[model samples]
Each structure stands twice: as C-alpha cells, then as structure tokens.
Target: MEPHLPTTIQISAPQHAANNPYRVIEGEEVLSVAFREFVLTAVAAGWKEPEVALTLADIADDYVMALARRAAAN
Candidate 1:
C-alpha cells in the first residue's frame, strides 16, 4: 500500500490590536512556512501521517502558548 501523505496544511496568523487585547483579526497566512518546515522535518524523521496529526493536536495548546509568549516578547 502506498503511504498516505498529506498535500496541504492550513496555518493562520492573527492580527491583534496593541491597545486592546480583545481586538483581533484572523485568516492570515502567517505561519505557513514554519508549519510546513516542521511537518517536513517530522516526516523525514519517519513519523507517520496519523501519528503526526495526533501528536500535533496533542501539543497544540502548548504550541499556542509558546507562540503567545513569543508574541508578547516582540
């Protein structure tokens, strides 16, 4: 059987208001490059597609938190 490789992934980048934390914009392609790079690295390391998906979902919250921290620092 052939391997089930993924052809696409969605990455979003939000625009946040500096004055108000509640004001935000969405639907931006901000992290497409980073996301694709990470996925390619994982695949090259022999991570199957399903495992990659499940692991990504599992660490999503932690990843978002890390991103938030990075944003706060900038």
Candidate 2:
C-alpha cells in the first residue's frame, strides 16, 4: 500500500457546526473510510464540534497504530 497522508477535515465554524459545510479530503482509502464512519456516527448522534474533533483524532491515532502494526508484519 502507498504511504497514506492524514485526512483533512476543516471545521469552519464551531458554534454552529453542521454536517453540511465541512470540508473533508481523505488522502488515503482506509483513512477516508474510517473518517467517514466517524463523521457519520457523530452526525447521527448530534455531536458538537469539540466532541467530534476528539473522536476523529482518536480514530486517526488508532488508525496510524494499526497501520504501523501491519507494516511491521510485512
């Protein structure tokens, strides 16, 4: 697999953060998939910007650790 860059999620407004105006650019397939899942879950749960940000960051960190393990197995 190619080296994957981190996904980019821009939250323009924190106070009135909705699912519509967010800018998401997933640089890698797996990262993109994980990111989408997190965002969807957050949206469904009606989470605000801070909570969503925390969850996304946690997901990204977990993803990187998983990737590292996979790489080490090769």
Candidate 3:
C-alpha cells in the first residue's frame, strides 16, 4: 500500500492543558508537528541542535527499519 500524506491536518487539543495533554497526529503532520515539538523540547533542555537532529534521524531510521522488517516477516 502507498503512503498517504494529507495536505491539511486537524488537531483537537484538550479543553484543559493540565489534563488530556496528548493529541492524535496523523499523516505527514506527524513528521512536522512531532519533530518540531521534540526538537524544541530537547533544545530547551540544553541539547545541542546537531545532536538533536541526529537523534531524530536515527529514530526515524529505526522506525523505517522496523516497518520494513515487519512487512518482510508478513
């Protein structure tokens, strides 16, 4: 099956910021929104930009590898 990336994404946030903090991220927006959040949060905690980027790339590579392994196994 081909991957589908939506041009537009809809995110419904919790009514209260203190609770129900997680929102569902779909399609390519997950790459943008989630990646941005991770980078910003990591940088805020004093992580260097290059290291953060490399970490994200490594995570993405691992995810794709896992998916490929799953498909091959099936």
Best by lDDT: 1
Q: What lDDT score is found at residue 25 in candidate 3?
A: 28
The residue ranges of model 3 lying beyond 4 angstroms of the native Cα positions read 1-26
List, residue by residue over 1-74, the lDDT tens digit for candidate 1: 45666565545445665665544323233565656677786777688877887888779978999999999999
RMSD score of candidate 1 (Å): 7.6
Q: Candidate 2: how large is its RMSD?
A: 15.3
Comparing 1 and 3 by TM-score, which wins?
Answer: 3
TM-score (C-alpha) between model 2 and the true structure? 0.42
Q: Scored by Cα lDDT, where does model 1 land?
A: 0.68
1-74 per-residue lDDT for model 2 (tens digits): 34444445543333323463432332344456656776766655567867888877898799999999999999
True-vs-predicted CA distance for residue 72, candidate 1, Å: 17
What is each predicted model's overall lDDT from 0 to 1?
0.68, 0.63, 0.67
Count residue pairs with overlapping backbones in model 3: 0
Pairs that collide in candidate 2 are: none
C-alpha positional error of residue 72 in candidate 3 after TM-score superposition, expressed in Å: 0.5
